[model samples]
Target: MIYLQLFWEFFKTGLFAVGGGMATLPFLQAIGESTGWYTYTDLMNMLAVSESTPGPIGINMATYVGFTAAGIPGAVVATIGEVTPSIIVILIVAAVLHSFRNNPYVDHAFYGLRPASTGLIGAACAAVVLEVLTSIQLVAQEGGILKTAALTLDAAAPLGGVLNLRGVALAAVLLVLTNWVPKVKGLHPIVFIGLSAVVGVVFGFAGV
Candidate 1:
């Protein structure tokens, strides 16, 4: 029953979230609110992890949310649900190629979709930025430096309840290395992801 629910929810999300992964953020937020499976904070973390990992951000987020909610079976169901709509749509459109090929209505529909997609994607980006920058003002106000610092760290790891400065430093260093080093310019993102994971593990073991 839980698996079925997961599938239905994600199917709806994928069906309507037409733009891209970022575009899916709003729908995912709607799902989060409707299902109570997670919170806005959880959504932010999912976005971060999804972007940092392999595969499309939307699919990755769906899998993450599903797994977090109901484990392995949930992940499978959610993934299939997210992709099923695309498969069905493509098949249907292929079968109706002539009806759509030279239709001005179809062309106009697509022309309209361009901006709608952009708006959805832009909204998603803004939401994520809000989550990350939620504490900026605290940090900006000199009197609340500690509070600001705490909020900033909470944005990264909600469970730790404390800032993991080592992890933050690791991320900062990687960002610099990836941007400034010519040799690292073309490296696959997975390499950096693996390195970040290793760094996180090491820091965790060291009690940092």
Candidate 2:
């Protein structure tokens, strides 16, 4: 039953999340909230891993979530669920695309979708930025709306005191290196990614 539920949930996400992998973040976040299968932090981590690895982010995330929930079989089911809609849609599109290539309605529909996809992707990017830049967490308090508060690394510190300075520093370094330094700007993105990983390790060890 859990496996079936996982498949169905991802199928819905695949069906509606039309703007590519990043756009699926909102749906995945909602799934975490509704199913108790994962948390927002887990989703963020999943996004990181999905982006770094060699597959579509949405499928990678589904596999990770499913495996965490129910092991290998769950991973297979979740992946199939995530890709099934795309497969069906592509088949349909391929068959009808030539016939409707110049149809006004089809052209207008695609034009409308472009903006919608852009908006969804933009929203996802904003969410990622907020998650990385701020140290806030949402908590539900009794008889009230959700409360927002900063997270502290040390228990002794006051609330909203601690920030992920390491992340900020790394982001700043990468931005400067890629944008300002001509030598570094010419390097491939993979080089920067490798350097960032090493820096992350150093910061991790330094308790940053």
Best by lDDT: 2
Model 2 misplaced regions, further than 4 Å = 1-13, 16-57, 65-74, 94-98, 103-116, 136-163, 205-208
- Top TM-score model: 2
Number of clashes recorded per candidate = 0, 0
TM-score of each: 0.51, 0.56
Give a tens-digit lDDT track for model 1, residues 44-103: 998889987878888899899899889999899999998899899988988787677899
- Worst window of 10 by summed lDDT in candidate 2: 150-159
For each candidate in turn, give its C-alpha RMSD to the true structure in angstroms. 9.1, 6.6
Instruction: Looking at model 1, report the run of 10 residues with the lowest lDDT sum.
Output: 131-140
How good is model 1 by TM-score?
A: 0.51
- Model 2 clash pairs are none
